[model samples]
Target: MLTFLLLRQLVQNAQSSSSSETVYLPLVTQPLIQSLPDAQQNHIQWMLDEAPYPALSAQAITVNLAEHEYLFLIGGGEQFNPQTGRLEQTSRVTRVELDENGQLGTWSDTGDLPHLPRRLHGFTATAVENMIFIIGGLNYPAGNSPIPRFNNKVYCAEVAENGTFDSWKARNQTWKINADTSYDYEESMAYHAAVFLNGRLYVMGGLRRGLYFSQSWDATRYVFSAEIDHSCEDLVWEQEETLPVPIRGHSAVAFERSDDKISEQAIYLFGGVTNDENDPTAVSYRANVGENGLEEWTPQAVIPGSAGIHAGTAVRSDEYLYYIAGTTQYDPKQNSARDNVYQTKILPDGDLQPWKALNALEYLYGHAAAVSTLGRLYVIGGAIVTNSTQMPLIQNTIYWTPLLFFSKESNPVGMVFPGEEIQYRFTIRSNNVRDLPGLVISDTLPTDLELVSAPNFFQNDRLLSSIRITLPINSKTWQTYTAVVTQPEIPVTINASTATATETVLPTNTSTLTAPATPTSTPPIRPTDDKTCVVSEVAPDSGTPRPKPTCTPTPVVTLSTTPTNTNTPTPTNTPTPTPTAMPTAVPEPVVVINVAELCFEGRCIWKSTAVTAPNRVYLPQIAK
Candidate 1:
């Protein structure tokens, strides 16, 4: 039965497209193993041995070794033990290998964190090259002490090429207390976010629980940074700019933007609880990393339905930022675990577009999620709430799916006139760490538009409606096509066309992804030129030289007065001076054509000219 299920999954993956429903891997750990058949029990046991036990609030990171890529899952709160029927916390570390095709190998036990008697949770772990740094979190001591201890120590370890870790060494310099305060301001914090950017580790907002004086928890707005030394021994934390507001259980992700000449690195902060522990804020912020530290953060678009989100995981895949499952409410008795996944696009200017919903997951929170080098997203252990008892149930199930990055955009966003030729750029970006082969991009044009020229992939003169190209890892390839508007049939016609890119992988196939171009609309309006007009072409027999033209004026009328014959003319009385009829010399009809230049792909092309005659104006038929 296990073999059959695996075969079925492979078949489904091969035939799946991006628009189809998301396909999840089979559940690795099941809760009701004892009630199942013996064969089923054996299969469950086999999977459990290769997977981590049920836990929550763990931190995950992807490490790329010399030849293989591995995902490391660090400390988390093991909420339950079925054998003892008790709750537990763990300092255990596990890892899984990701194959070239983005398939996961069996999970292996790496080593447990040392030097601390208690297990930790709500901490952050970051990878700087081959070394991993474990930052502040809450430590749970053994035996009846229900209160969790806050920590300020920083731990560092080196990961070997075989995906094993060396002994973790504690840094000599730890988080320091503020000089003005009697107590530590943000030195000991948990449920915070940390990111490594440009050789520096940045720690953002988090919750600091009062240990000595009071048991109340307060959210902090502090930000700190440290320069990581080559030997990982002299790491020192330096305070940076604080956040606009205090927050906890948030997520932070940093990415480098090389779209322009001056490359920039940016950090984004997502949804979390504010000062009030139960109040989650949908507000997000973005800031650029500079030589000193982070610049002022600018508020971005608020995430929809994110007011209830906390303890979510945010990961960046290419140009997209994804926020995974998080708890909605602070109380354990409420249904706090959320299954929604929010996604947003990271613009070139380090701003974010509006957030949109993707496929939902199992109702869980405090899960660890990471993107493998092969462009696959993996969600590790989390906990779900029971409906009847409102108790939390820790889950060991692991789920993963492929991530696709592609976009289509039109150059002229606003108004497209009739007979106007515009350009459409289709960009395909590979988020994988290795090159992806056999990528087919298919574009469908609207009926009202005609394709003038497209990218020549085969070097042949013939035009192709679609293209097949290979995408280099962590890079983007774009192609532009010239299209002309044939008719302005409706008041506002949106050229909503889709382009699909299908990747063909061996052994395990990935899905085909589709991205539609931002709609280009053509509103009905009379074509008019705003600049000085020049005659581009003239009739053959007219013998008129091409020159800048002006609007012809109507012939002015004048009255001829007889001057001194004043007396004589007056005597004629007024025989209303018989006006002589003027003979009008008719000019030949000249067609005034307005020419505009359109450039694309470093080459300029002429747009169709509007022809106006002496007595009538009309749009000329553009030759194909």
Candidate 2:
């Protein structure tokens, strides 16, 4: 069963009402936690197991576009029998799109990889610009032969909105695979880690076939750099740089930012086994990429525990790298895995602050994770060994946790029909506590797209134009820009690209009611108990019939009058009824009551904090 926690800020306000009337208040909520920088706060909340991938995860890869919180799970294998321990790979590509609210929707199949329909495991897929390039990978099929074959080919796919992939094309390679080079299997190794930095796809450490046990070391230590040529026909590879040790099952992450319009690029390497092939390493390495090529190789921190392989499935945000589940210490006897998640803070000098243990992952080994620009990390697909039964199993699971201060989504993206004006809701958020200086937001459109109008705020401030617009820092309002297809005959798609930037490199309710009895107020009974409510969005009524979830339509409030007691008190003469100036009068006390009800799934699950005048008891009728 898939399990996850729904964590939200719980808030509500109770108001006082007169005894003769009833009051209803809408729910109110407030932000519970203050914002912090992405590096400082841990997005380690209990992760959500999104709708699981449609396929099993023996060795699937997940690609996440940081700007768009979209996740793609591609190519994994399923074991037929537990006894044989055989793997079967498929060429299927599954797309998991996170809704605008950051919740995972249903999984959709986004076609298949180009060329052969083979399973891709242990290869690096890097997103450069609008396309993702899938490099050399192994295609292990369950034939009679025990040997597995790897592909020397590299494929590219165009990334479309809403998790759709297209334009699958293979890149031309210089290596001509013939009978002569077929023996040297290192030319096409799988299980390698990759990072794309400044147009360069850096491929590192993987394994290749050799003369069985009699052969010498078989791990490929050389890191190959692949970049796109001007024509985009094929990939250009630079001279490979050998690592200090030959490794495989490692992870490579390209982490950098823009400074003064110049790019600052760095790729970090973490966790892999040596040439011997089974022993994992906890050590990490780093290097800087410049115009010349890879430079300044630095051996980084060693994780505290035993050497771990597959640590590359880490989700990185800024300097913090969170290594989710992997093999803690590979066991030759029984394939042991770990669920521990470790955090390594990258320092300026290629050193790491001590690795801190965070939330434990449910599954480990061969999973993929990516942190969005908004600081949410998505973890998907892997193999896990359950504690109840220590048997290895394939997974099709997905989870996400907050890892940064900016949990809010910024990009204004949507789909529109042809010739329809799409009013893009442009939003700029200041993640810093201090005001950001000189902020600029830009939206670029194709020649076929038309800009309809400018926002009033932008026009009033003289920041709107056909080009880029400047936005004031800490502005919470969402500015709208209307764009339509200039030529309706053109194919309908996202015709415009929207972006928000800063000219200066800056970092980055309630209901109420009621009358009080003469001066004496109930001091609004503040219910110390707070509860959270989860509501689903309702679709608009269309001709297409979709069954409503058997919910009894809530009747709009319409009712008969509530009868009140108007009884007269029995007249009695009291001796002590001191008649001052031959006249005496009696005052009547005012009565008041209040109630709050908690509803769920079309019914009131709970009700509490109903207060009444000291001697009177009022039972509230819970909403059905």
Write down the RMSD of candidate 1 (Cα, Å).
29.9
Please provide, for model 2 over 376-445, each residue's C-alpha lDDT reduced to its tens digit, 9 standing for 90 to 100.
5677666666653444666666676532122111112222234555454433333211222332333344
Task: Show the lowest summed lDDT stretch of 10 residues, model 2.
Answer: 1-10
Q: Which has the greatest lDDT?
A: 1
lDDT of 1 by residue, 51-86 (tens): 467768888889988877888888787775444434
Clashing pairs in 2: 43-402, 122-191, 172-234, 440-501, 440-502
Cα shift from native, residue 172, model 1 (Å): 3.3
- In model 1, the number of clashes is 0
Clashes of each: 0, 5
Reference-based TM-score, model 2: 0.56
Candidate 1 Cα outliers beyond 4 Å, as residue runs: 1-50, 81-87, 110-118, 175-187, 209-215, 278-280, 404-624
Give me candidate 1's TM-score against the actual structure.
0.57
TM-score of each: 0.57, 0.56
